[model samples]
Target: KMHRTVLALVNIFICGCFASPPNFILLFADDLGFGDLGCYGHPTSLTPNLNRLASGGLRFTDFYCTSPVCSPSRASLLTGRYQTRSGIYPGVLYPGSIGGLPLNETTIAEVLKPMGYATAAVGKWHLGVGPKGMYLPTNQGFDQYLGIPYSHDMGPCRNLTCFPPDIKCFGLCDVGVVTVPLMHNDVIKQQPVNFLDLERAYSDFSTNFITTSVKKKQPFFLYYPSHHTHYPQYAGPGAAGRSLRGPFGDSLFEFDTTVGNLLATLEQTGVINNTLIFFTSDNGPELMRMSRGGNSGLLKCGKGTTYEGGMREPAIAFWPGTIKPGVTHELASTLDILPTFAKLAGATLPRVQLDGVDLTGLLVNRGKSQREEMIFYPTDPSEMYGLFALRLGKYKAHFYTRGATHSGTTPDKDCPVFAVLKAHDPPLIFDLEADPSENYPLPLVGRPDLQKLLDRIMKVKAQFEASMVFGESQINKGTSPELEPCCNPSCSPKPSCCHC
Candidate 1:
């Protein structure tokens, strides 16, 4: 009787494991702009794979990120809350920084793990690398992690030469202050990771993880945050000279093919029908980098500012037969990812106040997005680390506008109007549906409806400000040279230190 009972239990477990829940793949691009891809009307960048993904799936026109910069933007995406709520506010994290993603916060991986989903986080994880990777993806909930702990340009060990011999890795010698360490789980796999080969490496690692998950008949979540089209662009060998845009386009071109490779992997693994793939950017492009930084399409300004171009991102979702192929102008934010994932995986969410609403209706049923309003956070100094903008339906208002416009910072000839930082008395409001560029602010002289709309938006903003509670500011915890990752801490200064 005992043997029979054990056999029955084993059968039940096996059946449960092979029930085949849907898989998820989140392809997060670093600093990709709203108009950077070909599908988005960029005459050059030539993002074919992404265009194909859009043709066969759902494309979002008015999607946005919570923050306009790196650490904060990423924080909101994973936890479905504002960066201020997650403590990743004010600025990006550095190698010497002490703070990281708080352990108490529940991530998407943690939410799905209980439902028996296998998870992996690949590529740039700027969330945190504090205290010997105590704040890494593995600690936060991912089953396995293999990638850089912070921004690619934040360290040393990047190759001096890229695929095209003409392009050189400038400031490499000076960048030796902090080494870009490649990590797998908690161990530093390589310091000063080869930037040129990172995309290929990430693609290979992701496909392997996918293959393993399918073999086990386990649903998986692969969060692939790419490091391409950022600063100091470097395409892998043979990936250069493919785009009409300069080196930036070259890197983007290579990244698009990387996406193609993932698609091929999905098809080859026979999980194409079951997997749901989402492609989006962490934030808008870095217009400070000028031409190399990427264009914001028709939106205003770029990264590090409270503008439509700064927060708006190009988002695409593909799920074969599950999600119908079409484009939607629904207002969506990265904050919605967590709740949406929870609903899709049939998993319960943590007991916390969430900013993101479930986007499942918008994704599968072609229904409207649950999110109605979005609050944009500042990426400037600690003093300006408050709400920068607000979006309600078709209207967007800027409470405090700052960045790039400040002359000496970085002259951007693209943005003809250089408005310096200032608080708006009535608040600069624009109907995004009519003016996507945010070029024309609706005049209040003859429009009573405009005044009413502004009042409503201001009321929501005031209420949000009055009730919102912020976590401890981890991004401003301060930095120390000792906190930097070192593969071989013993080596000396002449280019050999921290190299393994």
Candidate 2:
């Protein structure tokens, strides 16, 4: 009996010694530009909470979202792979769209849940919906999901005949409007409510979930993807005309408050130190409403383009004792989140192929750069956008049909349809480090080595494009292979790192 008692004490001690892993909270904002936050640089933006976070955590200067659009960006973030790999290669889906995240692809939540983490997603879920296998958040591995299936502006307009009628006037249109009912798991819990209130409600719900999880001694993963500052911007009830910068600015302030509330909740629950919080935007600002959103400072272009404004974003990671504070100019992408989270949680990701490299080392180690080269592609065919952009070292080469706008609102309508015989384009190279805004395209007077680098970039681009096509083909054939482990033959080998 004494021996058994001693063994029990040892077991209890071990349990106490091995505390649960830190909880994870990913706070993602929709349509928030890199300069919208006070930390990143906003002359008039009041983001005290986010500013505090920057002062206390690690801020990334060169972080890029996987896509320049919403749906694809989220898909990339969730899967830690290019959205094209999962067949989400364009604008967000409407209710009838058959495309959503493929079921075969594993999500971070799904991978972490089995490791004893309580996973919950409390915000926008634009991946897909309806009778399709892709509609439900539960199907995607989220234990709890509470948000709209897509963007707040996706519902029918309050007045069917009104061109871009006040979406809030009718409040959460289920019929002619584009926005749908708020969903809880598979069920629509609330029908057609104001999206601003919906956002606030989700914030509250997220806080409550975190509090409950902490009480239960369960490590939790909460994905709070806010619909703040997105198009048809609507602030909460009392926040109308609250900012001098218009609806967009008002929406940003409200979003900041929501984040403050979450942080306060963490402190109240005594889990602030035991939590890892990541904050970033889905993509760059929507250029259609440029005044509504801020710029990426010197970064050129905004939303829908392959430019830095469209892909680069303000990224911050906060873990009291884990991630050191201060600025990190490392080139990191949204795709790195998955593998990083998995590593933190001691979760094993499937051996499926992925384009993202685990950036845990970069986050934990202040002096390391996560990647040396990154390729950006615009899957949207509308703008006649570039097929791919290769960022190697300081040089960025954009390879695309020069004249295509890919849905861009531009004065020039007609241009060349010629494909580059070689990936190297004399007019396409830009030294980003020297010209971050891409203001000056480098004069390729006689630089053959630069041309070679561009050629290599195109070769890699071809390989990736082929991979995307093959993945899509597999998906269509219903033979989409499951994600295997990183070391598995099915998975791609890790990318080479650049410690610059």
Candidate 3:
């Protein structure tokens, strides 16, 4: 009955022959916090474009990423499975990491590309890039790709005075292995990419893809994962020190403008009505950068933890004619993107245990979210891919709680990084709807009324654990010199290494 109902809802939009399959543009942000945008309540980081986007589209207050860090979170977003299920566990993959997201695990691009969609990917491709660059986005079903294979800040900075002073690690300062390659279709175009010109380059890449695809009358999917609001932040041309909230705000302002430019291109090309744009972050803020990092709003902690602040993101879904504009507090995740896009393209899901519930109904008709519960995976290496927290309805139970990596010892008791490693017996539960800050814990030791809730949660957890078949450990496979994206094997490093 559920399957039949889902098919019926899908037919309501695609109707008859999947007429005019909508274009999908997933604008994924890097380390953007919930409170980073004015729409989500950034007091000073004035985000006019993003604010306008939320006003004109649907905003999700309770949206999330599957994991709190880069590679794992991206894996789940693309595959619609938990990061562990896809073997991107134990935190993010480094530049020369030998392994990547398993080739067998199907991605959103893989699902859509075969359905006659001209797929292009831009910005950061952090999932993995090694083993002869076989793990890059081009191999993962994208027809065209441009940008760095990993975080731009992974390599040592040439100069720190241009970046935020609070930035802790000046790009793997000691090792300095990641000389980020600016690649286009697996070919290196630039090394140690000039960040200053990144905004203009990205704009040209995305707009050109949109324009060319439209001219060919091909439905397109552009997954533009941006490099914004992360460490070593720099504003785009004409965007520096403009937000008045500091350099972080400056970068955010430029990101908003970049998005605005895409929207304009869609409008100019007369495809705005047929485009489905999902704007969200890969994970939460990086708290180590202090003022250079993003704000999690009322949520606890930041990147590299299971806290809401680490995983929860600001989400906006815009479709000019189809989707009704409004705010939804219903639970959603980046995991749902694959299933939802599959449903949109009339494609079948890959034969595997997918952890996402399609949000087509909620996205198109303002119906209730298909999801009721959420499982939070630990992003901190110490926790080792364990289930850190569970959210059943409004109540969230934290089986284990820890702080972000490099967060250091702090006097802030509200931060909640315990000195000792003792698992909770009863589990600290919170009514997230009421206390979004996670300051007050609902003591479960003596509350008989909460026993049933806990039981229900445990039952689900047990089921998840029982059916789990974790994929091969890709991240744990140590980095190899063979995986580095050095264009010339003979050169020393950048500045002299492959300039062309």
Candidate 4:
């Protein structure tokens, strides 16, 4: 009877039914790749702090982000729903874009707020920014938000024309050309945020929030989505020109150092054992940036494609006394964060259905992951919407194909690869467990059994399509004429311009 009682309590703890709810800190990196960190086998890009986090916690080798780009992936992470279902689908939100993650969708922040958690979002918020700030973090669920509203490269750049009317169509830009404002809550704090110490600023804000939460004895959730490793990469303070991997490497070193600082704060505040930290990237590298971009290592392709490198990201979870230090090849994603956090915080799931699975079981090494399969959506929606990939167990099947070079001049076009997919009788299947690089597609010449795979793939596709019934799409033909970004506007302020 005593053994049975102990076993029951163990089960409760493994399932995240804690007597005291633990704090959460989700450290999200922008455009950091699967192989860019020391623990992930990057020969360069020193990530000692991240490496330490992994050493002291669990690392996921088969983890993924829901999409190959920013906003969609972020939406999935926050809502535990596919971006397609969340209505931020198919494409990313730009500065001043009116549409965003549907207001109806419940975010992880909202889930925890009811549980008495103080939440703060610090860093890039590409979900949406509108005239009344409809899609901003404060409107969503965050108690406070301090950071850039979008990617650093959104503003004007000297190398290319990144101003109004035309810049919306061209997504390429450099730092000096435009000033990306840093915001506090809904208001702009620094117009054209100074890039040199941006990482430090975010780190300091995160640490300060952690300190205050500790003082108040309130559990808090800090969403620190970094702005480094994205295009127009800038070195953080004390890290300029400090990497053998060049500017990109320099930025990573500083970012890792910032992580160390946050960890130190958590330790100093005596919350290290009670806090859970998730370290991962929003998506893979922006290969267009070349040396300035991240390395995907052995994985084929980088950002903006359905390839493993694009969606499969390096992830680590740390909770000193809770999760045992180890590695797992479990299928998990940013989507799982919400459900996992909800369970850990003793909160109820949202009313709507979610695509993510609760990861507490896997996190505590109690059982296999709840997730069995994942559907990969293409980043570029203009080409075709039917194109999707299904990952089941060790195999993945792509219903369509795209050009290999996403960093090409016209990255958005379906170019060189067919604009519309050719009829694939067998579809392209790769055994991911064996071919993580996705360099070879298995031939279906002799195997009648392959039909079973096709049938299963079709079923997955049908379910995904059916799930879209709940979606309230916010995608635009392009950045809406009225919703064009205002702050820069070599154009005057209009009523429709966001944060003008």
> How many steric overlaps does candidate 1 have?
1
Q: Which stretches of candidate 1 lie over 4 Å from their true place?
A: 1-19, 156-159, 164-166, 170-176, 381-385, 405-419, 493-496
Which order, best to worst by TM-score? 3, 1, 4, 2
| TM-score: model 4 vs. ground truth | 0.88
Give the per-residue Cα lDDT of candidate 2 at 147. Answer: 82
Model 4, span 305-326: residue lDDT tens:
7878788999999999789999
Question: Candidates' lDDT values, in order?
Answer: 0.81, 0.69, 0.81, 0.78
Candidate 2: regions farther than 4 A off: 1-19, 132-134, 159-179, 381-386, 401-427, 455-470, 473-500
lDDT for each residue of candidate 2 in 1-500, tens digit (9 for 90 to 100): 99656544543342222255668999898877777787877787767788888999999888888777888888889998877667776566555454567788888898889878888998788876645335568899898888877776665545422112233332333343223457677665655545546656887788889988989899999998888777666666655566667667777777778788889999999988778899999987765554754555667656766777778899999887667788887788888888878876767787888777777677666657657777676645222344567787677877642322221342222211121223444438888778887666776668787778767777765665566532452123221212110112232322111001
TM-scores of the candidates in the order shown: 0.91, 0.82, 0.92, 0.88
Residue pairs whose backbone atoms clash in candidate 1: 157-192
Q: Write the per-residue lDDT of candidate 1 for residues 1-500, one digit (tens) a residue.
A: 99655544543342233235678899899888898999889998778999999999999999998877888888888998887777886788887789988999889999999978999999889987777778999999999999988887886534556555545664453364656778989898876677677778888899999999999989899998888878767797757887889788889988888899889999999989888899899888877677778878888778777688888999999988788899999999888999888877777888998888988777877888888888887775343335778999999887777665311134344332355567877888889999998878888788999988988998998888876788889977887777787877656663357777
Query: What is the RMSD of candidate 1?
Result: 4.5
* Model 4 residue 466 lDDT score: 64
Q: Which of candidates 2 and 3 is the stronger one according to lDDT? A: 3
Question: Which digits, one per residue and each the tens of the lDDT, describe model 3 over residues 404-454?
Answer: 553333244434444334477678889999998788888767788898889
Query: Could you tell which candidate, 3 or 4, scores higher by TM-score?
Result: 3
Q: Which model scores highest in TM-score?
A: 3
Q: For each of the candidates, give the backbone clash count.
A: 1, 25, 0, 2
